[model samples]
Target chain A: MLFSYRIMAIPSKKLAKEDGYTRLKDDFKGYLAGTVFFKNTIIHGYPHIKRIFTLEEGIKRNIKEDGFSVEEKIDGYNVRVAMVGGEVFAFTRAGKIEPYASEKLSFLKEFFKENPGIVVCGEMVGNTPFTPPTDGFDFRFYVFDFMKEKTILPFDEKQKLIKEYNLLQVPFLGKFRKSEEPWKKLREIASFLNKGKSEGMVIKALSGKEAVKYVTPNADIEDIRQNARFVFDMPVGFFNQRVFRSALFLEEFGMDVEEYKKRLGDAFYSSLLEGIKQLKKEGVVREEFRVFVEKEETWNAIYSVLKKSKEIEISDVYKWKEGNRIGVRFSKIYRKTTEKLRRFLSGYAIQD
Target chain B: MLFSYRIMAIPSKKLAKEDGYTRLKDDFKGYLAGTVFFKNTIIHGYPHIKRIFTLEEGIKRNIKEDGFSVEEKIDGYNVRVAMVGGEVFAFTRAGKIEPYASEKLSFLKEFFKENPGIVVCGEMVGNTPFTPPTDGFDFRFYVFDFMKEKTILPFDEKQKLIKEYNLLQVPFLGKFRKSEEPWKKLREIASFLNKGKSEGMVIKALSGKEAVKYVTPNADIEDIRQNARFVFDMPVGFFNQRVFRSALFLEEFGMDVEEYKKRLGDAFYSSLLEGIKQLKKEGVVREEFRVFVEKEETWNAIYSVLKKSKEIEISDVYKWKEGNRIGVRFSKIYRKTTEKLRRFLSGYAIQD
Candidate 1:
């Protein structure tokens, strides 16, 4: 099933060193800079994750749809191996060369002596204190691709060499079909792998050419919203959460409410509210206010009057109180009455 | 007429501290990486007056063509301006913020104050010796691009603003008609700007979107060959010259003849000659025999053969004089061929 693997284009070192919530965002920007746009395997998360309810649900959808194959979530460092002059050297995701295990180094030296020139990609899994017990301290060499000079070796040849050399590989999960219902398949994989204290199943496209894309199994919508709420409820000001919310609000409204407030302060909000009140008294409401806050009961109250008669054009004024101070804003009304209300509100307008 | 410009992409500070040769290579490489190719500038004998040749002349037929226009090469230090927050700060190519140029700081600050949301690209040419110049110091501001939010201002708009602000720009050598006879245009510009002291012109594509391609005003082939021969004629024992010659030879033949001789010894050379004689007596002059040279005449003979051959392949053998006797063996190739050749000949390579 020709599945595209969603590769993380950003260098890992940049991601690891980032502090706070902005790290991911900045890294994402960097990734965008380096990436070629294409649809690929993507791990889905919940509420904040967007377009999905939960990470597990997304995974289940992927699994049910047979969107991808799953790989054992190896809890270890990510490394890339490069072969130069017939010798293989391991590099961390950040491009740092790692000091090889003495035994493994010897093995690798001998392997290169036989293979001559080929770069093999794999994962080094060990029993670190942070990892689960099932994943032992054994270094697993999951040979994904073998590059000779400039050519990539055939998959069959690579697999044969891996077996001949006794190189450990990631356990092969069953193949799944590629389908539009990728989320269903993802959820099933999430459920199946939920036993261990693993992060989640990494859903990689079976197509070997693309870099493996892993869908984190833990991105449940409720889980994400809960996390966001926790961040919001933290003792210190949740500037990240505030920014996140502001972004969400901006997406909904054409104007950046926070930016507007910062630029104009309470005066703008006060003037808007007073204008709405005066308009309401003159029985005129604005249409923009109606669409901006259709869910608010205050808008419905004014709409009720307008629904009955065109002559009594109702003006909707939205009001809210912070402590003892009340702020009000006018809504759009029918044209005839709106002109009359505009004149009445001019009397209360503050001079520039 | 429309003219193109070659903007330095990497910050000058980064380029200044790099190893001289590496800087040269990286300048070429970075130019390529930044979508600029075709190194059209000439590095002349004057350490301070490297000129960009902007004309072309066809040597096959003495047809000269006019090249691009000339702009004042600003004398101040190279500075990169980056927008941080709403304000822009001048940074050295090495990414260090320059403290001296208050005009740039104020210009950027005021621009940011007015625009509030853009990244401005400009050169902060100042009296500071960020790059130690061979000439007198003068400062000039050259505005290039303005990045608003995330969008880079159109090229035309950027040019318009540059003119409006009266910023010093790397002058445009005028545009010429694209022709098969490119060198004709190069020679014309060279002749036009042949002032005894001025750096020559740089011939570039009229679109400026293309990479900077150049021609030297007086780059005679004989002069280059003479320089090469001068280095080669130095005594075999002259380490620097010997290394330089070896490098030149290696570049031509993919094997270091001198180093080979050092490794194998006189006996090897004598035996190789004897072997060739025997092969000639046997009516078998293998192509490999044509490669090995026992005398200066033989070396010259081989050069003609190598020049004519599409692929030059030479056996990896060397003759060296050990004590008073000679011996033959294969030579140890340096890990980094270029560096090894430079080091083996000259006690030191050029520093940054």
Candidate 2:
């Protein structure tokens, strides 16, 4: 039975504005109006789990609380396996399939060729020498669920099927008799397995009901610790590309440019760019382009000015940064030349 | 003291992709790269909230269990009043001030003249009745917080100053002695208050800490319920603008559009547009023009085709429905044609 609540009715005037049905429709329209489809939604999904504690925390909590479970935290790629009809397809955390696994796709295709109705979910984990350390990157299969026709198999049954398929299943952490025990075990696991690049553990419910099926804790801390060394060690251009990609991604997701500025803020953006430039200049990040501050600021200032201007113009200051950080320089000579040129061409200048 | 946690320090590769910080040359550059700025942040912010909620179910829980405190839901336009050196400047929710208020700027000039240190936060609740409410509006000066010398006033002191100023505060709903009591009271209050033209309540913490704040349950429910009615009532064009505004707001908050689609789909949008069109035609909404949906399938199809296209254009068959539920053939064709023509000339032409 669907659980429902009876909501108080709203007045006609106020109701018109807050109508969810209409709001939903507008949302779909907005998406359709944009370029990318199913962009971040399919990858990130809604209600994304923000944090997952490290393995140390899990083990600690388990040890402290007798009721906790201590499962082996596997090192592998997070692959969300889904079944569409009789086919089983594995998607990376971001929903893309690995290009190197094209042969595996055929294997999957052949497997589905016989199993026309069943779908099995599992993680694909394997050992490779050149792979990013098992701490961050290890290929392992963690079978989570399965589906058939319109029915999703129970958690236990899904686990059973993983063994039947000979797929690598994530070691099942024993069930905690008490809820509080898990927290302690989580802490222990975080502390124990934290050494030597082992990222952490993800505590998950055997019966996955909620969208946030798993929790990761010390993983983020580890991530921060590992990356802090490079904080001052990346090239300005390289770093700039990363920043630009994020902005473009935001824009691709249909975010307004103004919103980008508000969220990042002037000071923080300034610092981040400066950090990258410093890293590059210090030979930490190898690059040849001279990292200059004045030129960068001028471009930003111009962009800021043009952002709200009625007319859009390609200012001479606009220069391409590594990827898309359009940098423009403003100087006395350039300023005079621009004014003189503007005055000279005022009659012929076209209004945007 | 700052709360610190040990985490695996893996910095996001996307950090370097931010546009604003990519070109800077200092150590601080790109720090704020992907962060949402006030203006740009909103676009990402709303979507981020959506994403967070989808994962954690926090917002849904908050909406259901944390029955919102019913304050006098302000009827006046949303205004953000800021005091700079004791000079109070009022800005619309979008940050623009009312034109008439510009003439009254001198009234607060003396406050700045007298004490250039105190800054007050207030809202012009019932000042301009440009959009007259069917019911009488009550203007209250509800003060939430304050900022002075770049630092916010202490929470307790801020409340005291608000009281001292004799500014009308959004009334506090009683603090529940028991956790369960608040939810019960919420139902009762919702039933009692939702009958009339009252929009709904704005719940706040009685301790004056902005710990958790939300709109009343009644309002949320009303919004959803009315959405169905609005679809059948309002015009499509007017509805589209409202949707666009909401989208713009979300984009300004740096929200991903996909989240919007997942939460609110095409069917809901079309229904709302149709409802608005109907409302306008029936003289319910006084607006002259109405928002119309070109076709039901057009919205859905756009996603399929334009998922990768940077720019897209599409057109579909549309029909207008009046409040009486009578279908009007091409009632808005001329208006639609003009809008499409204008957009086309502006290089936004995609398809029809």
Candidate 3:
């Protein structure tokens, strides 16, 4: 993903304090742009940037003159897992705490018990529907870079942490000299993952001065297909992010926002219409469903919840005695078709 | 669905007899396009057309001034099931015999056992992966109109046949008077099928003078979503037809061919690239996957097929005794990556 660098200036801590907590922004620099909080722990922004250029372009521009280490670029979401104040947290690229990552939180907390305040930067791959195809692998975090606050830990220190903590890391292709042939090195890097079909390589200078990505043509094509297709199937929040990311990707390919809209905007609009139509169709049948409340202490609560809900209308309630307790059976229906329509629309709507 | 009227002009019987089978052409005039044969019996072309205008437009234009009967439009593929020489056969809208409609074949054959020349024209709905959501219904034949060779049976006669044969017919909405309010009639028609969310109506004149369709906004929206999505998911031949249909749909919406290409061509290209990349990835492991052929009488034929195939490579062959019979074992691999690539590419390729 690429964006105009000027548009993504790092927000200062003073601003974060002023705002109480920093909210995520659409920043394509991949640089840690801000700080936010979940409970008492600070969720730092991920600040890794990759240059977007073909290997040929990089070579022509003399950007790869410095010797670089190549790492296999895993097709997965950027996640920062850290243990702060003895509690574990996982944040997606958007800097929001991910509840789904709770399964791995205890394992991360174990690492934090030994070494607190270390940030594990990794690509969260597999299991999740959102992640790219993982080639029949289990979902696991692959730590690539470790950091203490804003400073990146040295590769050796990171490796040692991974080894001691039993953390999975991104597959390292190899160390490459500037004199190495670009195509041959690329081929070697590609063969390092998923049977010679790696996404590409992330080239990081040994001195940590610069890091850039060289995506294989195959990977880029796969990205385009995966990004364009099944977007309608994404939950609204993820869909919006994907659409925003698609804009950035198109921009990187020199396609303008207007062009993007012209090409795919109708599909998005059509999806919305489809959602609305589905709601209208489903609302008719779902509204008049019967609910039986068994005799229990929580029956009153259930009744109150149904009675108070503006969306649900109880047309009839019948009292019944069962097992020495009283219960009620209610014929409830949706108060308005618009209520179901809203729920349906939410699944397809684009959000900021 | 729109095609040039002049180009679709009827071909002569001489041409039909000379060609062995004369194919149907797009005739928006709604007259029987042509007759074609399957073995000995003739299959009639479905000559149905709808003026692409709202009921109001039709009224204002004085096109649908006479009284008409409205029928619910089911979104499905047009299928013509018939008995040709005591054998059941189904023809697609293009009048080509369809082998996939085998389930309906036996039923049609039973019907043909009594009335051998009858052609049941219907929309094949449900069961298939590609059809619009069938709302949990099984695959069915919803007969809309019926014909015997080149002649169409009247509405009442068709109903009798459907009742006698226990066949399903497209749900009839109601008869509309020209003096009635077009909007009111449309509303009545809309409320006629699927609990007020009808795909719209197909209005036929009682005098048999004119017939036209009025597709609801909901149906159009459903169509757009269905057309844009799951295109790559369709089988190659159907996928190509869908792409072509999508182009025609866009043109109906006043979008030119170039714009259609500009909007959707990339998705097709991306699908191709995705397919190629997948083939490359899968081919890596699949090329050397082992296969076992147990002792069989057709071993020589199997061996010949394997030997002749450009796709398979036999690394080793040895005589074996299995199940008290002699057999040959061959360690084989795929001969060419390009062969699989070509097959994969064909799946996602778009045809005009």
Candidate that scores best on TM-score = 3
Q: What digit string (tens of lDDT, one per residue) describes model 1 on residues A1-352? A: 2122224445454432211111222225413111111122111110011121134333443333344455555545555454434444554443333433222333577676776645555565542111222323334455545656434454457668889888876665555655454545555555555334343444443333222323232222112222221121222322221222222222222333333223221221222333345454644443332122212442343345335554333345556663533333443344543553343223211111
Better candidate by DockQ, 1 or 3 = 3
| Location of the lowest summed lDDT over 10 successive residues in candidate 2 chain A | A18-27
Return whichever of 2 and 3 wins on lDDT: 3
List candidate 1 segments past 4 Å from native: A1-69, A82-88, A101-105, A127-145, A148-158, A179-186, A204-207, A217-352, B1-352
Tens digits of per-residue lDDT, candidate 2, A57-144, equal 3233323333333344554444444333343444444434332222233355654565554544444443221123233532344555
**Pick by lDDT: 1 or 3, better one:** 3
lDDT by residue (B67-185, candidate 3, tens digit) is 66677787777878877555666667766554445343456676767776777787876633124334465467788877775566766676678899887789877666766666665
> In order, what DockQ does each candidate have?
0.00, 0.01, 0.01
Ordered list by lDDT, greatest first: 3, 1, 2
Error of model 1, residue A105, in angstroms: 4.2
Q: How well is candidate 3 docked (DockQ)?
A: 0.01
Give the TM-score of each candidate.
0.23, 0.27, 0.36
fnat, candidate 3? 0.00
